[model samples]
Target: MTDQYAVLGNPVTHSRSPFIHACFARQQHQRMEYRAIEAPLDGFESCVSQFLQGDGKGVNVTVPFKEQAWRLAACRTPRAELAGAVNTLWRDESGQLWGDNTDGIGLVTDLTQNVQVKLEGARILMLGAGGAVRGVIQPLLDAGCSQLFIANRTAEKAQLLVEQFAPLLPEGVLLQGGGYTSVPSDGEFDLIINGTSASLSGDLPPVNPVIVGAHTLCYDMMYSARPTAFCQWAITHQAARAVDGLGMLVEQAAEAFLCWRGVRPDTAPVISLLRQSLA
Candidate 1:
């Protein structure tokens, strides 16, 4: 029987997960089926329970449901616990729910592997202090970034996030957080990551253009067929490179696939194929 998987979210009609997973399965010659599931706003728990009770083997949780999924899973990976959210879930042979967050690894892979930007000893500037930002902080810090500055609309949230993760930082890895308005007025950073939802509203968060000099690499966690507001703004400021999060999405899905099937999917081909289709 074909193993079953799905991506669960409200307003899931626009999800490309089904298509992405199908491509992955085809490339790996795996007998599996994946679909998009629309969960009611407040009915996430019931929806997941019902799906698992049936033939569903695993799910990728998105948006508002990620935190809820984290709570529902019987066990969570270290990364998921740090993120305080679960983006991937699977049932083991013992029928126990396993949770993990691949967003951090996904972001790291896209930045270092796909974009060819070295994270080691790099100065990083991250936009936003929400769940998405929280998910990726640990991995980025682990990748040997010399310093990370998290900027958000609300200063307190950023400070709280930094404090939460500060204990985990290596001796020399600097992590600081504050409002975007508090961005240092000094030098440019090696990489700038936009983890904010500002792109969804077609708005670019207020950022210091001086922080994005010609050599800075700009990455937006939001992806679209066209350049997102953040990506466009990065370009206008003459960033060395501006990339959207499409590759991150695929890479994260690949991580989830590895966790479920114990096999890593080659993401480059899938990313290229999707880009072509979008074109």
Candidate 2:
């Protein structure tokens, strides 16, 4: 029998996980069935329980339910524990649930491997202190970035994020948080990542365009059928490259698949298919 997997979200019809996973299974010749599951907002736990009780092998959790999945898991990976969120779930032979957050590793891989952005000793500016940013911090720091600055619309929330991540700060690797205006103009950063929900609202953060230059890489954690607002803004401001989140999505899914099946699925072709579909 084919192993069963799915991605769960409240509003799940729009999810591309089913298509993405289908591509992975076909390419890897893995016998698996993947689907998108819509669970009621308040029924996330019960829905997951039901799935587990069936032939479910694993699940990809999204958005409003990530936190709840983190709480429901019997055990969690270090990254998931640090992120306070879970996006991947699996049940062991013992019927114990395991949670992990592959979002950070996915983003890092997309940036360094796909985009060829060098992270070692690079100054990074991240826009937003929410779950997305939180999920990616450790991987970014681990990639040997010299400094990680998080700027948010609400300065206090940004500051609190820095505090929460203080333990992960490596010696000589700085982590700072503040309002966008507080970002010093000492020099242009090598990489700038947008993790804010501003793109969802068709808005860019209130940051100075001067921060972007011809050599800066601008990345938005939002993907659209066309260029996202942040990507447009980055291009208008002369960023070296403006990338959306489609690659991150595919890479994260690959990581989740690896966690469940112990085989790394190739992601480049899947990303190409997604980009073409979007185009």
Best by lDDT: 1
What C-alpha lDDT values do all the predictions have?
0.93, 0.91
Tell me how candidate 1 scores on lDDT. Answer: 0.93
Q: Write the per-residue lDDT of candidate 2 for residues 1-279, one digit (tens) a residue.
A: 678998999888889999999999999889999999999998999999888788889999997899999999999999999988999999988989999999999999999889989999999999999888889988899999999999999999899999988886888999999999998678888889999999888878988888788899999888989999999999998999999999999999999989988898989999999889877
Model 2's number of clashes is 0
How many residue pairs collide in each prediction? 0, 0
TM-score on alpha carbons, each prediction: 0.98, 0.98
Q: Which portions of model 2 miss their true places by more than 4 Å?
A: none
Worst 10 residues of 1 by lDDT: 199-208
